[model samples]
Target: MANIRFHPNHDLLSHYACGELESASSIMISAHLDLCPHCRQKLASIEAEQASELEKSEPAALSPSLNAMMMEIMAQDCVDIPVLDEAPASQLALEDKAYPLPSILQRHNDKIGPWSRLPGNIKRAQVDVSGDSQMNFIYMDSDSALPEHTHQGQEITLVLAGEFYDENGTYQPGDFIVQTEKHKHLPRTRDGQDCLCLTLLNAPLHFTSGLATLLNPFSQLFFRR
Candidate 1:
C-alpha cells in the first residue's frame, strides 16, 4: 500500500465527479483515486452532494401511474444477473522489473506507446489520451536525476510506484503533484530506490541551469508525441 501524502485539489475532484475534466487529466485523477482511499471518500461525498442538489433542482412528484409502475417493478422477483469475469490486472514491464498498472490504465492498455529513452536515465512511454495535453509514464532508474527545470505550462504527476524527491520534498506512491511555470526543481531518486510515475504536461518543460540549458531542444522529444 502507498503512504499517500499529496492529492488533487478539491476543485479538480469536483470537476472529475461531474465528468468535466479532459480525457488525459481524467485518467490521471482516476488512477490516483485507485491508490487513494481518502480521495475515494471525498469523491463519494461530492457525488452524494451532487445527487442532493439534483433532487433539489427538480422537485417534482412522480405521477400516480409512474409510481405504480415502479412499485410493480420493485415487487417482481429478482433475477440473477450474469457477472462478467474481470480482466487480469495489467503490468508494465521495464527490464527485470514489472509494475501493476492502475485499474483505469488497464482499460486503455492498447493506447500506451513503446517506452523510449530520455536524457538523464529516464524512460518515457506516451499514453495516447485525447485533448491537447500529453500523458506519459516516466521511469527513473536508481540514483538517477533529471536536470532542474520549470514548467512551461502545468505539469501534473502521480507517483505510481516507489518514490522520488525534489528540492521541495519526497513523493511516494499516490502523490498527486502539480507544478506550474512558477515552480522549478530537480527530481531524482535515492541510491537504492527507483520510481515510476504517470505524468501529464500541458506544455514542454523548460530546462534551466548549467549545461542542462542545452537540453532545451530535447524538450520536444517529450512534447511531440
Candidate 2:
C-alpha cells in the first residue's frame, strides 16, 4: 500500500536485477525499490527466474586437469584478507527535521554535500557519485515552482517526501518519474505541501520558457558537477 503511481518499466528493473544498468541509474532504481513493495516483488521474481535459467544453462563439469588445478589452488595456504567495515547509516537533515534515507544511499551520507539555495524556492544537495551523471536531493518549499524545463539527456526523479505536480500528473512519495528530451513541464508543490526528491540527471536542464530561458546558462552551474 505505498500508493505508488509510477514505477520503472520491467526492462529497466530486469536490467537493474541483472546488474546491467550503469552505476547512477542503478542507484536510482535501488532507492525506488526501497519505497516500492511492488517493484521489490517483481525484482524477486526476476531473480528467481535468472537463478533457474542459470541452473539450466550451467556447464556440465570441469575438465579433470582443470579440476585438479582448482583443487591444488584451494589446498594452497590461505592468505588473510582484510574485510572493510561497513559504514554507519546517517540521516538527511533539513530545517531541523531529519529524514531516513533509502538503505542504498545510507553509505553515501558522507558524499552528500551541504544544502545550497537555487533559483526559485528550491534547495539542492549534490551527491558525489563516481560517474559523468549528477545526483541531487532537491527540496521544494511549500507553494514553490520550478520554471518550465526539458532535459537534454535523461532524468530520473524519485519523490522521497511530500508531493509535486506537473503537466503529466501529481507525484506522491515513492513515485518514480523518468523524463527525457521529449518532455517539458513546470513542476510545483501546493500550499503547505513541500516536496523532497532524489534526482539523477545525465545532462543539465534546458529552461524552456520566457524569463526562465535566461537561466539556461546558469542551469549548468546548478546541475553539472
Candidate 3:
C-alpha cells in the first residue's frame, strides 16, 4: 500500500487534487504521479473517501427559484481577472524552457501559480507552494548532486522528472523518497535532464555538507525563517 512517507504531504496532495493548490504545485504533483504509482493510489483512496463522505452527507435540494437566482448571480459575476503582466510573461517562458539533460532527455516546468524563481546552479529554480510554510518545491539541474542535508520534521521528495540515485534506490520520475527526522541522505542524479521535484519541507533543512557545517551550527537558516 502507498503509505504516508516523508512528510505527511497528504494535505498538500488533497489541496492539489481539489484544485486548491497553485498551478505550479498542481503541475509538479501531476508530473510526480506520472512516475510514482504508490502516491497515486493513496490520492485515489483519499478522493474516494471524500466522494463517499460528500455523497452521504450532502445538503438537501434547493428550491427552483434558489437555483435560478444562483444561476443569475453566476452569469452576472462572469469576469476575467488580470493574469500575465510583463514580468509574468517572461516567467512563463522560463518555466516552459525544456532543458535537455543527456541522451535525448528532456524536461520542462509548466504550471500556473504564483511561482518565484530561486537562485542556484544553471537550470535550477524553486517554486513556492504554501504561504504557511508547510510545503515547498525545489527544482534541480540534471545530473547535479544536491547537498547533503538533514530535516527536523519528516522530509518527502517526489521526483517529477529525470532520475536520481541514493541509499534507497534509483528514483525516476514519480518515485517518492520518504525520510524520517533522524535520516540523512545524499542524492546524486544521473546524466539526463535535470529532475524536477516537489518537496514538502515541513521543517528546516540542516546543512551537513562539507566542512562548513562542522564549523557553523547555524549555517542553514530556512528552518529558522
TM-score of each: 0.89, 0.86, 0.53
Candidates arranged by TM-score, highest first = 1, 2, 3
**Pairs of residues clashing in candidate 3:** 23-112, 35-174, 36-174, 101-192, 142-194
What is candidate 2's lDDT per residue for 1-225, written digit by digit as tens?
A: 368999999999999989999898999999999899999999999999999997676434878888688778867999999999876667899987788887898976888999998777999999999888999999999999988899989989999999999988999999999999999999999999999999999999899887889888887786667
Q: Which portions of model 2 show Cα errors greater than 4 Å?
A: 60-89
Tell me the alpha-carbon RMSD of every candidate.
3.0, 4.1, 8.5
Q: What is the lDDT of residue 95 in candidate 3?
A: 67
Error of 3 at 213 (Å): 1.2
- Against the true structure, candidate 1 reaches a TM-score of 0.89
Model 2's alpha-carbon lDDT is 0.90
> Comparing 1 and 2 by TM-score, which wins?
1
Q: For each candidate, what is the lDDT?
A: 0.91, 0.90, 0.56
Candidate 2's TM-score reads 0.86
